[model samples]
Target: MSEQAQQTSNSYRSGPDERGHFGIYGGRYVAETLMPLILSVEKAYKDIEDDPSFWSEFYTLARDYIGRPSPLYLAQAMTKHLGGAKIYFKRDELNHTGAHKINNCLGQILLAKRMGKTRIIAETGAGQHGVATATVCALFDMPCTIFMGATDIERQKPNVFRMKLLGADIRAVTSGAGTLKDAMNEALRDWVSHVDDTFYIIGTAAGPHPYPAMVRDFQSVIGNEVREQITEREGRLPDTLIACIGGGSNAIGLFHPFLDDPGVAMIGVEAAGYGLDTGQHAASLSGGKPGVLHGNRTYLLQNEDGQITEAHSISAGLDYPGIGPEHSWLHDSGRVSYAAVTDDEALEAFQLCSKIEGIIPALEPSHALAHVMKIAPDLPADHVLVMNMCGRGDKDIFTVADKLGVTL
Candidate 1:
C-alpha cells in the first residue's frame, strides 16, 4: 500500500514525531527533575525497536508468554438474545494477568531489559495495571515499585495482595484526593528521582506520545486476531466495534488496525458517573474542552482557570482527568463516536453478563456492555458486533453489591 493509502486508514494514532507526541497532544510533560530520564528511555526504545533481533525476540515472547492469540469467542447465547446482531467477545480477560494490560506490561518489561534498566516503576488507579506490572517484574527479576492511591489500596485489596505476592513495593499515595491522580503524581515524583535504572510502564494509551502508540501496539493484537477470526466466521467486518475507553488504550488498539474501513464504525464508551449533566462524570470527549496537561496538549476536564479538574467515574479505571491525544483527534475528525454509559447501567450490564453469559467483566469494560444493551437490540440479527470484555469482575462484587443494595 502507498503511504497515502496507509495514511488515510482509520488508525486513531498517527504522525512522524518520534517522541510520541501526536501533533501537539503528546510530549514530555514531566517535571524538570525527570526530563533527562524520560528522554533517555525514549532514545533506548527507538534504538531497540529499530533492531530486528529485539523485535523478533519481543514477538516470540509475546505470542508464547502473554498468550497473543487471546480467543475471539462467539457470544452465541448473548447474540441470540439480542435477536439480530452477531455478538462475539475478544476475550482478553483470559490473558496472563487477566486483561489486556499484561500484553503491554510484558512488552515494556522486555524493553526495560533491553535498555539495561534494573528497576521498574508504575502507577495504578484500580490496581490492574499495578498487578500486571509487578507480575512482569517478578518474571524478569527486576525490582518493582507500584504507586497507588490510598483509597484504591483499600477498595482493590485483592489486586494489592496480588501485587505483594508478585513482590512489588507498594506506596499508597495519601495526597490530594487520594485516587489515581495522586498515585500518578507520586509515581512521577519517583521517576524524577530514580532516573538512572527505572522504567515506568504506563498501563494505557493515554500518556505522552510513544506511550499511547506503544501501548496501542502492544494491545493491538486484540484487533489483529479479531480480524482473522472474523474472516473465518463471518467473512466480513462488523458494522461496528465497541470497547470502553478509560485512557482509551483498548479501544484504540482494537480500532486502530480497522480505522480505514469506512463502512465499519468504532464506538468508545466513557463513564457517565450519575449522569453527564450532573457534574460527576469522566466523559472527556463528551463533556470536556481542549487544554494542555501532563506533558501534552489535549482535551482536559477543566475549570474556569483552565486548571485540570478531577474526573469522577464509579469505575476507578475510568476516572481519568484527561484522555489520550489520539482519541481527542479521532473525535474531532469524526472518525469515531464517543458515548457515555452511566454507572447504574454499567453495573446492571455487569450483572447481566455474569448471569447470562457466565462471564463477569470489569466495571471499566462493563461501560461498553451497557452500550451493547442499547445497540444490539437495534441491529439486524445477521449483523455482527464484538466487544472487548477486558477483565473479570470478581474484584468489584462487594462494592457493586453495596451500591445497588443487593444482599449478595
Candidate 2:
C-alpha cells in the first residue's frame, strides 16, 4: 500500500499530535522571541478547550451575533441544470459580514478577551476577514489593526471602506506582490513588535501551532451544522463535500467534521489564476511543494532554489502561496482530493450561479462551484453534494464588472 493510503487507513481526525505535528506537516516554527507568546496562546486555548462556559459564550454569539445554523438549501435550479447530483448550498455567505470569516473572527476575538489582550491585529486578503475582524472589534470596543495588501485594497474597495467604517486601522502592505502573503508578513511583524498588549488573529487555518487547529475547531461549526441539517433533510450524510481553499479555513471547516467518514468524499478547489500551465496560479497543492511558511510546514509555491514565489488569483482571498498545514496533511494522506479551477472557469461559474439561483457567490467559492459544474453532471442524480457558499459576491461586484468589461 502507498504511504498515503497507510496514513488514511487508520483514523483521519486524530491529528496535529501534542506538538501540533499533523504527519510532519504542522509544527510551530517561529522565532524564539515569539515562542513564549505562541506557547502562552496554546496554553490559554487548551485551558478553554473543554470549558463549558467558553463554548456557551461562543454558541451564544454564533446564534445572536453572527447568525449560526446559517442554512442548508438545495439548489433546485442548479441541480436541475446540472442534471446529476443534487447540489446543496451551505449558506455561510448569509452570515454576518457576508462571509464565513466571521465564524473564526468571533471565536478568536472571544479568545482575545479571555487572554486579556486589549488590542487586536489581523491580516486580510479578500477583505472579508478584515471586515469581520473590524466588526467584532467594534462590538467589543477593542482597537483593531488590519494589514491588507495595497492591491487587495484597490480591488476590494467596498470591504476596505467597510473595515474603515468599523474603525479598524488599515495598513497597506506593498511588499511581495502586494497580496495576502505580504499582508500576513506585515501582520506577523506587527505581532512580534507589540506582543504585550496585542493579540494577532491569523485569519486562515494556516499559521503555527494551535492556530490551524484552533481556526478549524471554530469553523467546524459549518460541517457540524451540515451533518445535522443534511441528515434531517436528506435522511443521510452527503455523498461529497466541496469548498475552495487558499489557507483553507472554510474547506477545512467543512471537511474536518467528516474526515473519518470513509464513505463521504471531499474535494478542495484551489485557484488557477490563468491556468496551471502558465505558472501564474495559486494551486499550491497541485503545483507547489512542502516548505515552511507563516510558521508551519505546508505545500508552498516556491522556486527550485527554495524561495517562495508569487501566487496569482482573480479572487484576492485565494492568492496565497501556501495552504494550512492540516490541509497539506489531508492532501498527502489522500483523505481529501485537491483540484484546480482556472480564473475563466470560476468567472463563468460566478455569473451562472448569480443568474440561476439569484445567489451571487464570492469568487473564492465560485472556484468550487466551477469544479462542481465539471463533475456534477457526470454523477448520479440521487448522489448528494454539499458545497460551502463561503462568502457573498457583493464585495466583488466591481471586480466582476471590470472583468466583464462592464464599467460601473
Candidate 3:
C-alpha cells in the first residue's frame, strides 16, 4: 500500500461495532419478522468482505462496466470565479447512469446475485437510484422493481421513463405527501413480503444493520479514488471535502476515506427547501432530533408525537426526513459539519456552475456547490476544496425549466 493509503487505513478506527452501532446512531431497528433475513444478509456480506475474488469481480466491473476512477478535475473557471480556494470536482457524474448511484448499485447487485436472489427492489427519490438499479438488473437479467414517490415520479419523469425503458417495474408510492420516506416504507413492506426471492437494494447510506455499512463500503470507492487522485495531483490531502446529503450515501462515500484526517474539514450540505424556520426543509441534522426511521436510529425530522414529517427540496435527491446513521453519529461526534442550503441558493449555484464550469450539476450536488460558493470565497487561495459531483443535470432540466417559468 502507498503511504497515504496506509495512513488512511490506520486512521479510520471509528467504524461501527459488530452489531452495526455507530456510537448508538446505527443499529437494527427493524421488524422482528425481518431480523433473521437481515442477519443472513449480514453474514453473506461478511463472507464477501473477506473474499478477494468477490472484490476482483467487483473491481473488474467497476472499471470495465461502471467506469471507476472518475476524473478529479480542477474547475479552473469555478476557481477563478470564486477567487479564493482552488476548487476541484470528483466527477462521478460522468459514470454510467450519470451519477454516483451506480457505484453502490453495482456492488449491491453483485451481492444480490451471490445471495441467489432473482428479483431486486429499490427505492429512489430523484430517480437516480431507481434508474441505476434498473440498469444493473438489466445487466444481470434479474427482475427489478423500483419504488418512488408520486411527487418524484412527476418531477423526475425522464428517469421514471428510463427505468421503464430498462425493463423495470416502476411503482409509484402515494403515502405521506408521496415522497422519498414514503417510497422507502413501501419498499420495505415489499421486501418483507417477498423475502424469499427479492433483495432490497437500498440507495443511500441508511437503513437497518448491514445496509448502511454495506452501502458505505461499496460507495467508499469514491473517497478511495479521491484520496489517491488528489494526493497525486496536489501532493497533499484536500483541506475541505463537500457533498450534498439526503440519505448521505454520496457524502459518506466521499467523507469515509478522510474521516481519520483531522486536518481535512468534512462538510455535508442538506436541503433547506424554503429555509429551516419555515419547517418545510430537509435539514435533518440542523433541525432534527434523534429518532428511529426506516429500520435505523438516526437524526430525523419528526414531530412531538414522533411522526416522521414530510421533507421538501427542489432537488428530489436531497428530500429526506432523516440522514444516514453514520452521518448522525459523525455530526454528534464533531467529526463532520452539517450545513443547509436553500432551494434558491442551490439553483443559483446550479446555473453558476453551468455558466462558469460548463458542468450542469444535478440539484443534489448543486446543494454542495451552494455551500462551496458560500465558503470558498473566504478561504485562502492555496486551500483545496474537493466536492463530489454526484449526478448530472439532464434528468433535472424539466424541473429546472418549470421552476424558472420557462416553457419546455
Candidate 4:
C-alpha cells in the first residue's frame, strides 16, 4: 500500500485540514493567478462555517424553496422481487429541479450572494447542474453562463432546453471528446479570466481546495436526513448506503454523515460504459491510478504518458475520467467500497425501476440500482439498504429511447 493509503485517522469527518487535503488526495493545485481567488473562497466559507444565520437561511430555502426532508421510501415491490435486503429509496429525485444537484447549487449561490458575486458560471455533464444553477440564478436575478460538452448537449437536449428556458447562456465545449472533463476545463478557463465579478459554482465534489469540501458540506443534507429519517422509521442506522458517482457530489453528500458510523457500509457505483477490460469505462477508482486533474489529486483514467483518456458512459453525468478527491481518499482508506456498473446493467435497472417501482429514475441513479440488484438478493431480508435516487428521468427519455431502439 502507498504510505498515504496506510495512514489511519481517528475521525473520517475531519478532513482537508486547513489546506484542503484529505490525506494526500485533495489540495489546491491551481495556477498562481487563481490562488488568491481560491484562498478568498476558502476564507469566505470558513467565515460562514460556524454562523448559524447562514445555516438558518440555507435550511429555510431548502425546506421552503427546494423541498427538504425528501421521503425515505421503502421499495416494497423491489424488495420482494430481490428477496434479500429490504430496499429503501432516498427520494432526492423528488426535489425541485428534479435532482440532488440543486442541494449544492442552493448552498453555493447563497455563498456567491454573500461574496457579492454578480455573475455565475458552472460546468455540467448531464446538464442537471446547469438547470439547477440557472433556476437559482433566475431566483436571485444573476446572469448565468453554463459550460456543457457538445456531446452532452446533444444527448441531454431536454436539460439544455431547461437551462435555456431558465435564462442561462450555454457554451458548448468541443474539446477532449466533448464530455464532462472538457466542460470543466472550459469552465476553469472562464473562471481564471473572469475572476472579478464571476463565481464559478462547480457542479460536483471535485476541483481544487474548498470546492471538494464545500460541495460535500452542502450536499451532506442527504446523509443527515437519511440518518434522522431512518432512525425514526427503523429505529437504527442502515446496513448499506449506495449512490452513483460522477464527480461524487451526491455520493459524498449521502455518505459523509455516516462516515463515523461503524455499522453503516457505503458503496459508490461508477459508470462502466463497457467492460473495464475494453478500456471504454469511466470507473476511475476501479480502473485508474492516482493523478492530478482539475486541480486536485485523485484517481483518474489516463494513458501511459499521463494524458487523460476519454471516459465513456451512457449516462452523461458519469462520463468523466476522474472522481472526487474525497472519494479517492475513502477508497484508499477502505471506509467505503467502490463498484462499477455498465451501460447495459444501468439501462436494465432503469427499465426495471420504472416498471416495478413506478418511479422513472435518471440514468445516474440507475447505476446504483444496478449494483443493488447484484447484492440485494444475497443478503438477509432484514438487511436495510438505502440507495440515493439522485435524479428523475425526464431529462434522459430521448437518450434511453435511442438506446432501446424506440421512437420518442
lDDT of 3 by residue, 208-316 (tens): 9999999999999999999999999999999999999999999999999888888899999999999999999999999899999898999999999999899899999
Per-prediction TM-score: 0.94, 0.98, 0.97, 0.98
RMSD of 3: 3.6
Tens digit of per-residue lDDT, candidate 1, span 14-76 = 552666655456676767777776676677677776788877877787778777788888888
Candidate 3 local accuracy as lDDT? 0.93
On TM-score, the stronger of 1 and 3 is: 3
Local error of candidate 1 at 407, Å? 5.8
lDDT of 3 at 179: 90
**Per-residue lDDT of model 4, residues 324-356, tens digit only:** 999999999899999999999999999999999
The candidate with the higher lDDT, 1 or 2, is 2
Error at 336, model 3, angstroms: 0.5
lDDT of each: 0.82, 0.94, 0.93, 0.94
